[model samples]
Target chain A: MTEFIPPGTRFHPLPSPFPMKRGGALVGAHVAFETWGELNAARDNAVLIVTGLSPDAHAAANEGNPEAGWWEPMLGPGKPIDTDRWFVVCVNSLGSCKGSTGPASMNPSTGALYRLDFPDLSVEDGADAAASVVRGLGITRLACLIGNSMGGMTALSLLQRHPGIAHAHINISGAPRALPFSIAIRSLQREAIRLDPNWNHGQYDEVTYPESGMRMARKLGVITYRSALEWDGRFGRVRLESDRPDEEPFGLEFQVESYLEGHARRFVRRFDPNCYLYLSRSMDWFDLGPDGLRQIHVDKVLAIGVHTDILFPLQQQQEIADGLREGGADATFLPLESPQGHDAFLVDIARFGPAVAGFLATL
Target chain B: MTEFIPPGTRFHPLPSPFPMKRGGALVGAHVAFETWGELNAARDNAVLIVTGLSPDAHAAANEGNPEAGWWEPMLGPGKPIDTDRWFVVCVNSLGSCKGSTGPASMNPSTGALYRLDFPDLSVEDGADAAASVVRGLGITRLACLIGNSMGGMTALSLLQRHPGIAHAHINISGAPRALPFSIAIRSLQREAIRLDPNWNHGQYDEVTYPESGMRMARKLGVITYRSALEWDGRFGRVRLESDRPDEEPFGLEFQVESYLEGHARRFVRRFDPNCYLYLSRSMDWFDLGPDGLRQIHVDKVLAIGVHTDILFPLQQQQEIADGLREGGADATFLPLESPQGHDAFLVDIARFGPAVAGFLATL
Candidate 1:
């Protein structure tokens, strides 16, 4: 049976060439994970956590790490994720950092990093690898699968690919399908990265790895993710001294611009550029309408969203619930109010905790 | 005595190197006009039409030319700015094209193209110059000064600088001071031009000017001048394909984008880039309450605004009226319903015309 590891806990690797879904000719995955608490008698006391685009297996609370799994507050001993009562599993999806196989992993064919040679990654590959990790941990069934944003996408894919694994779902701030605006925004990011001369077509041994492109992506992405009111509130036209104050372009500028540009630069330093592209593509192709969701059958679902988000906003969540209802699943729509925008689900844990707790109480 | 010109139009020259306030310099300007009906026996039958940012001498009717001045219907013999009763005179402001002296004009001091060397302009300068032109035309008092956007700003500055001009004021969709958000957005356009390699630090000759920078500036300007709701209504992600399909560098993106960019490029060709910079700055620095609202006296005011404008929005118009009221001026605030956003005054002439006509009747 699956076990749950509490906050500040550690886990050992359950290593395997997990046979990644990219035709097996070019890509394979090494799956690993950790669990919290012991499985109940029915082995249905397990919950899986799908994380943001760059989240990893140390989804546990690590002290002093702000970038730790976005849901740190909800996953503690008696918190909503409730490691004390439920066996919880979190797997780093394919084409990511941490334990799962990714672009940085060695290609058996070339005996080198997959790099640009990494096959086009699909959400299915990540889903397949996640299921492998689940079954490997002896988790035969889940009480619920909770996903936020990109993580929510993987959770939805899980229902289609594995019918009986998860008993229920809670998708927050995500869509059953990718919208065109989302695709267009992603295309711009991809272009930003691809256009950089320093990228050297993704072969650069240097650490730069298209920082400007990543900055552009983050700048544009941040705009989509937040509401216009949020922007005005956060960084209107307040000015500060310029970084290059002595230079010719010396002058004060809007504080919002500096905040956005800084966020982009910071992302490039800690993240692998290839991982962002691969993961973003996974998100772009995540549409349940055509083939993915039509094949999936969930027993019950709870799709939640916040009002201020423009990214995977409330409308998209409604679409997910509607799509699930069309697929003959019992689905519910929950619209939460918060000003934190697309990141509200992660930031507003106090409000979200009750929603998850209430759903779990019903179970 | 100044002679009354005919209703269609008349060309007139304001005295050169006009008088200036202390620490103020004159930007070169020439006056153009169109009148309706006859001048009064005292040579006092005159109202002034303070045209918006991008209009010319032809204020009232799209006569022989398909494109007349922006406020065509609102400014004619019988319209709100009644050319018949009041000897209506409209003059192109200094630092503008359409026959006014700007960067494209040869520098009288150096006998060379001023280009970047054009004296930094301000709202005080525009108003002061307009006053000089009217004074030179032998009209000591204006029956009313009606303006929109920058023209509204010019009216406010005229009230601040030369409070002796006849008191009736019509300021549509503008503010007494530039909001910080306005400053930031306009700065982006300036930077796009200033940073362009071809701009050569604003020294580029007319024939080899930075077309790309101009296009980018215009594109940015279009966003501020209109709303996204209007954009979706008009374009809705519609691509504008040129005859050269599969053109290099993905030529001509969305129709709306292309339309604005094309307009911008052409605008820079005819208009002066330096003038754009100067004019935007002039709008930013407008403030009647540097000391206090009561200190600056402005009486007899009609403040009209559109709901869709994010630039110099209705909220600011309300503030302007509030300021005028506190300063002992008769203030009226009116919100015009139009989908045209900031350019509503110029775009929806039918709706704008009647409101203007009614207001001018009272004036």
Candidate 2:
């Protein structure tokens, strides 16, 4: 499948022979990024926005791309992140297929798709790539670093690996390490993809794309992305008005089932399956031991989470606060009661936006 | 695959041309059951157990069958159900493959496996079949009716459909209707089975089994069956002792993944995939609305659930208690603090056992 790159996404060439964390190197590689607003004369007013899995660098529309981005509600001028005051840079993680060099990219060495031949990707490698992009933009020190979900892991790695990279940090719905429950869920998701005969060891073409496997994986993800409370409130035993297809006896019957089917169908062809596998396994392998947080030297830290998020529970945010506080940073933990679960940071702007804005105002 | 029937399960012939709840009839049909203890001359001391999906009629070892049953710890001579005092009859759910006439059974008219040709099976049908077994044994009324998980739905249907059939009811981790979250989960499970090429419209045999699809479905079930808290407490970030398989890049790396893989492998071939699809869809179709609960006429009722249960959550059990209480029955809702989640009734018997025995003692 083709890589999903948004229009006007800028690329930053990495140093030749860039070393990967798990003993591999990439040559002639580049990271995809998009910027909103301009850096001040000092170049210290820049705020880097690292994203979660599946989001492109197109967080919000800029001069180059007028289309609304994924986090358009919170990233535009005078919005929560406020492009009027802060120059925001959002970079697609290194292993993503969204205009970034990943398994879907042609290997300079072999002139073929990397696929399974791609070296093992880790969250740390993503951190290094983001760091390189920040440096390439002529920013010596970011005013603040914002990371959401998987990017939270990357941010922590950045702070630990490259000290004094940022003055303050905002970790949203992320963990220092992968939890067992989350690992199990992702494991099943990868299993679903691999089990598809169409997957064919990642050699699948557009004609034989692993649509069913990707559908199942995406459905499982959508289920965990929200809380059961939200599901009950929204769809509660609501059956489809139309008759189920006679040929498929167990076809769509409930509204919730139809909702999931719609979601999975839209997603299966949009993202490269190989890139998903690599990024997902990278999370499972992430573990920033207890001491990793204490090594960071940021001035201030804000860890935001929602109570309904089972994927990254509220306690994980509290742990971030506690750990960063132990490192002598003025850390504050804010837990919101959003019913959207792990995806609340993206959808529940009413709850998350103010917290982020207030934290940035302090900086 | 073949039906997984335990030794010494007795069958009671159904009325010829047994009618199904959803527009079809079964010929030469039978309901499978196993008994422990003896029914008195008055038959008033008889107790009946309807089961969740995938359990056999042999709930406990009997004189005819010495093998330990699924609920062995909670049943027997001096166990929680206390067969020594009450003659206990456990019936295999009608649409299940464990010694019951399910999709795996041969059709009398066609002399071939029913498979997808089997009529739509509902929880009500299972209730009717269990009611038939009770009446066939010459028992006018049950001392107490016990239902666990899906069986709880069947037991509710029994009380509403067959008035005065059971004098008391004990619902363990059961819901009045299917929740949207649960329906979505089960729908995905059915989709997984149907998408497998080997399923071949439910014409799979031992040689052409849809093992991968079944494995994925079972793994999904196992993940939802237990709570995230239990997973964290049991295998938090524990890696496998052995190295991951070199051939499979996304193979088992963590202990939780290994646990799910082991669990799914043991379950795939044990139960027929067609039977699984039928039974799973039946639960998605089960919904006894607010008025349905009010229609039930029983003397005493007890609904038990655990706080950690996400599949059939604690509020659902409370709903059962509240609804039944409104129906003029003496009902008690007991929520236990078991970290085992939905499967707590099966594994955390220390808490579930006393509740069942206490309810039965009053009966």
Candidate 3:
């Protein structure tokens, strides 16, 4: 019912009428993935990599494309992931718009964009979609499963829903469930999008998009993703020093504001607002307690947390490790001191890479 | 010249052509203040209380009205302020819209609301207006000056601009200069107002106001004002759990969101968006360093900071105390440990009250 292209960035369609969590189903569903290295004859040497909110299936440079990906530093021939030793599978998340069937995709039943009509998704649903892709690749078991942030929640859900599917798991800067402070931050982001006059209740055309709302929301996101210490050390009330004195002196006063606005503009160009709303809500809905961890039958698990991460925080990672350990799993906790906050997993290659590599070596 | 009403809850007008910080002046400018107790015959026992960004001159219940004020807990007969022992003067800042000369006030030259046409203001300008009010009451020197947040900056500016005006000073949860983190937070809030389609560049009438933008901005403010630890302990993943499941499950899911939205709605009702933008920018521009503190002619200074304050961290308050001490003034630093964060001075009376009372007893 779904076509499967070759490895190295391909799409795999789900069976028709794919059921979702919270009582809803999606039709003509598919997932996009990219692979590195070769799959062993036994199909047991595959390492699965899940991404954060905005990243895509392109995790690193491949033979066809020399361009670097979001996690380029952690992947390569001799990098932490060690693509030479294992086949690395990176899946674009279920609700994302980057080469994936999401809110931007056409609805088979209505012949229109899914938009707000997309069914509510859970981390478990995203895991099921990724599982379908894995099974289609003729893999019975994963050598290792790794994820960061929201991806971390999906990794836990994957292990819970499909027990014994992975030999080892690594969760980086991920939470068992979204905290109240983070939920409040994301709720405001969604409100920013919905308040845009161009949003038109999620029915805007491409030319008249909710760009301002998305831009403002991303500005807020960048602020929360980094630590105050880091911002203080870096910006420190430095003026932007613009040449135009006649322009309105409201938004572009501080260097940090300019940096945030630049990042917001770049993000709004790539991300779909509806997809952001759905995925952010999905993160809020994610919950994996002792019972859920008890269902995960992995051999070894390593939980990595950054000290400065306010969104997920170090305590959430500790909870994950504790939950897995309490459920009779070999779980190790690695806490890192980095100023990058929740984005440390994506930025600090020196600290995060070694911990992930050391964990993979044992498995 | 502007008219001056009686001592209790009245307006003191400044001379014609009141100059501002960055050029441009306000004609027929006046300052609104409320007096508690009586100025001594010597005119030397008056306590001047400058307000934060949102508060008004109504610091406590008075004879005219029995309604409680914003800082009612801290300002009674035997409270930390000690109205029974000393006369108190609370003045609304220069650019605020609470019965003060601000964007909402009429411009004599144009015979219309100043709105966006209002001149830019600074902490020093606010201090000058309050100084004029004190002189209007025929008091040359104040016993003490107390301010918190933006008001603290104004008090410091007053000491720098006109030395020996106040005998002693107390700065609570305020920084000598606004940091990049706080500037970025406030910048986004202003952007929210400017981006509102109904804003119309701060010229909207009462009916078609930029209420959504102000509501969203206030939500952001509440997030930054409080600590993450407090929210985590108080509202960690608690759902609102409505009985009706069909009422658009977007914003009303989490209790935290509901809390923030409720505060935002109440703030939007009471605050003018244009004044918010102006005052927020002024806070960003406030920077008083060694050069400024060296001009202080006070005998004693007390600087209090909350450990959980992310906006104005304890380190900033420590800097103020250290700067004043280094400049040969008797400055005492009190670091508070409260989960209330920057808003601790407003919420936690048990801790902050004793510190202020003890310090005032010394003065």
Candidate 4:
């Protein structure tokens, strides 16, 4: 059993000897979370925000850090996930490098960085840890749970593994299982990092991180996250940094190429390679259909899908709602029309905002 | 001007001091080409076959090497491109490593490998060389010109540059210009190769080729060549090598992963990395729309496109047919239904054979 006791704005250690899903266990696992608004005495207005593969607990701006959150558009005072009416708690997922217990964390037993020695993690473990954090905060139940991408998987896993934790759940652009196309994409990404000579088989030091491989991997990721239609409209055959006019005819001529490389270079600094491997694998291994949604205890479920999403296509989201409905649950399937594709939840705020806000309003 | 005096099954030298499109010139550049069947006395039944990236001059079996061709299903004595009625010649493109004058070819000026010193190549150059080969063979008029993917671009360039060489042209899944989406994909692929430490700035020896990066790039290419729907129906979520599989719960669990890796491994042996960079760049540089098809002198044009092709969509094919028709040439647009996507022309033989055969019969 895990227990979380939190003070201040940082992380809180989980109860000693936390067990993992696949074999092995973590002794001193800790979770980092950020809260918005005040928890009512009744503690029924608290909202839990689960994150995707790359984001941390910084879901919104608060007193500690005035910087806007990754989901700033949806988390402000009068936004879809309005902070004014609900207490929001966002946890930095387990097995991530952003202030969470992961490969970068020190092992309590060996006093060394866990690195590859870190135990394998699943969405179940992440849901359990987040639940522990919720319990540690003295909130017995949550008003709603919102998740996107990998977070969507975690939210569903949470409802399946520990029933009655959240009254309603919102899942966006996620899957019941990783499809073959997605698995192939992720496998290539991991190969990019593993093949980097400097990676030293995931043991590279700070001075010798596989920046080249990681950057390329990110470039590939950025391509898959968005749709070809989105790119055609945004960067259609336009040249970048062409003011000099005497540019070489051979390299980086298109604006989209420059955009991908620039974004990837920036990403290499903030993200950890080992954490990427761990989290990506966990997502691929995630499968909740086998357990069936009949056992889910949530009061309401809202599943949103983007028509252009190639990774977790609309069919997967429809499957989620269909399965839920077939199991006698109140499920609403919202199909979104947007060019943003898999990243629609993050980029096409105008479409996602009202849908989420209206649903939360009914609750 | 280029001159082809062929004595063997391999290559015919281009006219010495060949001029390039953007500037510069090659001293002793040559083209690799293979022919099937006999040339009629009138020498008017010759059909030129253009290829996509990575294919060689071998399009069908002949006396020299009786091995079946890459397009064996569509090439034979009575195939769509019948060897009995029409003499067929397939050219290994310029800037390719398959026995053609490319980055791997020796630079006569320096007696060293051209490597990065290879003159910037474009589709126009490929067309120019192909036209010379046709002239060298004493074929004053071609019965038909068949091309696919990059080959399609080359065939159109040939028509635009030197008209009246081919009476009819068939382009399959090729674009008039490289779209931003395709350019971005190609750019990332080049980055993967360039970032490999073993690449050594494209100067690595045979023993130190950047196999890992090339394999990853090929995997990415494979993903784009076919559709997600195709993978779903084919590999689904099947595990890789599952008999007594002590597989770590994380890496390469799907069968598609192993399929991609296997194909990539085999590809690395037959293809050169420098050639990939050169040819990919050449494709990006190809743009025939700016020059206009008003100058095209072909008698008939048939453009085929796959509905699911993300790289070169059906709309692009429609644009091609529209432009040709507007320019006073007889053009027909044929849309195919196949999950094979951009690669449908190569894989969906049943659909392609009838259409191509019917077109050839009409000619």
Q: Which candidate wins on lDDT?
A: 2
Candidate 1, residues A57-115, lDDT tens digits: the string is 66665442324464678886888878778888777777775555667667778887777
Candidate 3 versus the native: TM-score? 0.94
- TM values, all candidates: 0.71, 0.98, 0.94, 0.94
Put down candidate 1 lDDT per residue, B220-278, tens digits, no spaces.
56666775446546765455565334242222344554556556666666556666766
iRMSD for every model:
5.4, 0.8, 1.4, 2.1
> Who is ahead in TM-score, 2 or 3?
2
What docking grade applies to model 4?
medium
Error of 2 at A362 (Å): 1.4
The TM-score of chain B in candidate 2 is: 0.98
Q: Go through the candidates in order and give each one's DockQ.
A: 0.12, 0.84, 0.71, 0.63
Candidates 1 and 4: which is better by TM-score? Answer: 4
The backbone clash count of each candidate, in order, is 7, 0, 0, 2
Whose DockQ is higher: candidate 1's or candidate 4's?
A: 4
In model 4, the clashing pairs are B2-B15, B3-B15
Report the poorest 10 consecutive residues by lDDT, candidate 1 chain B: B1-10
